[model samples]
Target: MNTTQLDYTDITEIRGPLMVVRGVDGVGWDEFCRIDTGDGQLRHGLVLEVDGDLAVIQVLEGTTDVVAEKVAIRFDGAPLRIPVGDGWLGRVCNGRGEPLDGGPPVYGREMSSVAGWPLNPVLREPPSQPVLTGVSVIDGLTTLVRGQKLPIFSVAGLPHLELATQIAAQATAGGEPFSVVFAGMGLTHADAAFVRDALDDRSAAGELALLINTAGDPVIERILTPRLALTIAEHLAFTQGRHVLVVAADMTSYCEAVREVSAARGEVPARHAYPGYLYSDLAGLYERCGRIRGRPGSVTILPLLTMPAGDITHPVPDLTGYITEGQIVLSPQVHARGVYPPVDPLSSLSRLMRRGAGPGRTRDDHLDVAAQLLGALARARQARELAELIGAGALGPVDQAYLHFEDRFGRDFVSQRPTEAHTLDQTLERAWQTLSSLPRRELTMIPDRLLDAYYRSDHG
Candidate 1:
């Protein structure tokens, strides 16, 4: 359909970011459109739907001054496309991919659809390589793997943003050519500034790219933030053969934008007024990460979303948990205690931890040590509950030891300085030091050989 030759003046209704045109022909869904206001202003849009002679368009920029009688629409007959290339590295841009660093425009080597294709399951190589995040809790516990989609489930006021930035500054792809694409959705101006400052070193080093959408930006632009990021990442990982790590912060805001648009469209709402297709919509973004067989690079995702009112059952986090491989749950309780990451090991998991850790990948004893540490932490939690009811005086000797072990674990292992990046060996050594406080009899999860090699019985 050559929509350029056909202009429509039949905008029958203008409803909150949406405009409906009547007597339209050969219009297709998702085709780009340009809305020309009578007073020399233009707005870009996408055809949301087309039925018979009626077409619905979602205005990319909000419809602030659009008059139904004087508006004209021209369809481009194509979905939204973004120019992508290697030149995007070490650059900063807004959610829509416009330069925010006062730099020149990105001269793209190629242009690609923001709506990426799903990887065939048969072509996906099982994610196995460890992506060392330099955080002891993550590297030693919930190991992030190459091509894995792992999310950080957080609450308001927690330092998930700080943690995400720290990971971006320190994570590695086993000495491979690694890159990071950070997408900040609906962030405040101060938060956006914080991200730029925190990642300045990485950006200066040409290892990071930032895409930020502030709270004041249009809601529709927030919806496109992650898509633009993933499109660029796909180009980097597949075409350029660079292992790319995409960090998307506050996806809850993105979901809310989705819900807002859904409301404007008058679509039937599902859970919590979110559209029924919320699951598939989120999957479309997360499922884009993986290593294709015979390809030299992979795309690993770490999407951070805050659960509204600390409710995990909220549609956003709930659906995300189902799609991603696992989650790193940040604990308000631990955060209140002043832990840097506040990662609740009991609540957090990495499904690919086993495949990424152990032997040659990280350490031979990583799997065993992590299991023992978690088991000990569980006992410590139980002992703390008992002490709360019966007082520490009534606790048994083993219970007392477990309490001390827990204190050491949180202070030494779980808590780290924001800039302190630990290697796999340093992390493992700290794990062993924390576990050495427990009695040898309680260390059943660790093999005897490992105990003799790394564990110190005298410290127990």
Candidate 2:
């Protein structure tokens, strides 16, 4: 905790966004810096590494016309911090936490570190409450639980961004105090507009906070977007007692930025030229979520990243799967079939769904119905593959029944309009309708008593 601000004029080298300062004394890691470009222009930067008397500084605004001898660099001797409170709701900000919505600057009484404070593992409470995203496929099957970290895995050209925005706008905490903090990294201008327009109502209602770093913005800012979003979310949830959901989209961009910065630093690369600490770095962000024991509110994270070349084994998605609780996989095949969500049930999973759904939380039949639907969908997949090899006429009656069930399920249950929002009860009813097409004998996963109550023989 050095409090002295050091000013220096001797810069050793400049490359891309990184600049090396020589003859520096007592500079700390992550300390904020100010660069005066001699031409009366000022830019902000951060200390990335401090070695002996030399320090590596990353210019947040990039370095295009910086003159080493003429530039004046000042180390602030502290990490970056932002104002946090209720004032952030309904406001749009850039990656640096500056206002982008043309509103007044946030002048709250409290400030929090952008790097985030650490939570004790002993104090972490397991997630048990449900966070309902109004889409039937998610709410009825892989239910999102409070304080959970779930990633949405999608390939290029899939509408994962649209799905992320829809959930941010429509998710609810069962009439409890709730809010959503959305962070979009490396988004195009059009994509940023789509996110803002989709969440306009929520913003007006003071239940949303948007932080966007566009593709044209500084590449260094992309690394800060998620941290800024989570800092505000921690303030709103733990301090203000409101359940906060943090949605970070296009994390692939964020990782690329990391790889770029790593390359700039002359660091040795691991897989795909990403740093060796990729997993730990991702954990630093995703682990910021969940409920702390004795804390009134919770922070849940939903991150969306595109799998490069449709390869799930890519370093980004593969490492993400290891860190997050579960994933919601979007399918190109399903998307081509004209489904709005295109969620592949067999591919998606929620590890904490059981804790959030069931008799007391969502519905008594929720777990049972989800199980039955998955079983039927798996059989249907097998039946479709079999029919593809041998003509449809060669399939038996049971296989034909599965084929019909798959069609009805995709048409009736998995598909929903982007603007439409469904309640848990409505989602359950839709689940039943899709399941009804199957014979009563196929539903061995559900209890007989519960089946008699909700199953309609005529619906098939």
Candidate 3:
């Protein structure tokens, strides 16, 4: 392999955010490069493609005011690598890992590739531990598990960002050494500020590392932010032995960037005009989480993406549901009711919750209570529909009781302040309180032992 720096001045075609170099020798793909323009300004670039004697370069800061003949490009003979270690905590960096908080550039003794090292499938342990997100709708029903990739599926105009940031600011792993790596892609200025303000105390306490790529920034940076953030998280979780949760928001922007670049390169498009390798590309990021055998630490991921026009069958969410464990779906109808989290219980699910929330992990009665609550909610929905068809005054007592249960469940179990964080026990208590609105005989999913011990008829 060539390890020597090579400089080229061959004149070639220039395109949007891309430069084609002629007469290049031994230039490798993804290799870093420095671009010096005639006006004495230096820009960063990445090697996108290489044939025998020609290479395509992607300008990181874009190709404005860059003259093809006046620019000299130098290959650094290596792929993109960044300083990685404990020094990243409490720091805010841009997509390229450059400091944005007025602090000096983050440095450490070791540098790691942004493209992470793959984990061996044989060495992975099944996820069996709970990650408390402090939201009753999630913790009580769709419990997030360690070493899982559970995405939040939302549509535009919903408060998915608020729910994601709140979870990142408050999630914990039962008194263990925990940290959060939050990456925001193509965020507006106000959205970025909200993230900083929400996690300010956590950052100050050395528990957070934030990376932002704003709407005004280069689109190429949006493609790099999650990879860089995950590289940092893998360092903290695997090398240093700490539980790390990665929260990446607005992945829709990231996919758009991928589609934009694909169009630039003239690659054949797949569903929804995205690159054909979209599933593989997303797997490369989401599959980076999990626990390795004999290792005490874990990396859990909760990525948030908006569904275009609320279409669940869209390629993004559809492919994500195939790659991830399950999804936590946010609803506009529930948000209209003024619920803080607005998670639709009928739509949201955590496929690994059974393995993560049963006896010895969260509580012995956790599964039973979850079953009863969900069953009651399903019945409540039917009763409400029935009431709409037939006048409420004509309903039977049992249906009326179900309608009452629904109101209590939505208010007591689903609604909470944005800043509120509930413990697992508190969440279960609220579940029991909501169930008490139904008759004792109606709660048949819960075991007799737990019903006798925890059931209270006062709410009924």
Candidate 4:
């Protein structure tokens, strides 16, 4: 029952998505406001900045037909908040938390600020549990740990979206009550439909929530998509006590929207014309995930961002690497080779993998086997390069064997059907089968005990 209303009609300027109302007093930053367009249309906005008596407002619904003389503003004296409850699952919504599934409004006893509160670092428990994504490359190589922020770095025209959808559909956290909150920012209509259809089973099962902001939607709404999704995910994890995984696809679109707003705000641009506070802004979103001490639930994030022109050094991916735990780098070469996921293990890493994988967690030989696979792949890659220079006929027996091992690794281990979901044990066993094609001595990274138990030489 917040009845504090501060009304203003001094509409001085109307920028692209921002409105400037002068002669205003007692309006705080981030205060929610309502704007009436005099044509039975009411729009919502948030005060971005308060400079003396001038208040800069970002119209949530674009200021398409807002007449300056007739428009009236009513400030709510609070930040933007959305209703939070378990009823959000299995529902499709837009960036502004409006239901898109033609369902009734979400009923919640509590309202949560879309700009979530930060988790205290002292109260955070170290992430120790593995979040199995069912993709052999991710589960076997760079294992995703619960509560960790791992990003997928892809380029244009790659199957990153498909990989993300499959992971959302099949990811699990052992026996925990698992749920997924998927947010797609600046997606095309077809891509949005694809995401909905891909997670149809999970949504029907009441384990998935979707927030989609298509390209046709207002650019400002793109910035709110992930925030809305994360807010609901945080509520589900911290309040409902369920392990939540938030998968936000194409964060580049979100950043671009941020840049657009920055430009409109006349803010000073940093690298690549993005705002200077981009790193801290992304940190605010990514750092919200983790396991709180004495809490039974955790929130893990897999934020996907495409590298502009395949440049990992671009500000978006570069700044993301600084904020997130590690990255899963997708390979266009592997994608062209018809490999599903197309994850370049050499370029990808999970900093928390060592903590969540190994004895008693996945398998006793999990770490050893993963190391051996990487070692063999490195040698195979080198052999392929040498063969390109000297011709395959001139290669030695070991190098030629490594060349064959590379093919099997890509085709058998890395490649899988979209519907295929391999358990950790299945992924490890497949790793062993692919390793068997090479000489037993080449697996120096694995222990002799594991080798004797799982290795079978083709020579025998």
Give the winner by lDDT: 2
Q: Which whole-number lDDT from 0 to 100 does residue 175 have in model 4?
A: 80
C-alpha TM-scores of all predictions: 0.97, 0.98, 0.98, 0.98
Can you write out model 3's per-residue Cα lDDT over 93-206, one digit (the tens) per residue? 988889999999999888988877557899998987999999999999999999999999999999999999999999999999999999999999999999999999999999
User: Which residue pairs in candidate 1 have backbone atoms (N, alpha carbon, C) closer than 3 angstroms, thus clashing?
Assistant: none
**What's model 2's TM-score?**
0.98
lDDT of 2 by residue, 365-451 (tens): 999999999999999999999999998999998899899999989999989988789999999999999988888888999999999
lDDT: which is higher, 1 or 3? 1
True lDDT of residue 446, candidate 1: 84
Off by over 4 Å in 3: none
Candidate 1 vs. true structure, TM-score = 0.97
Q: In candidate 2, list every pair of residues with a backbone clash.
A: none
Clash totals in order: 0, 0, 0, 0
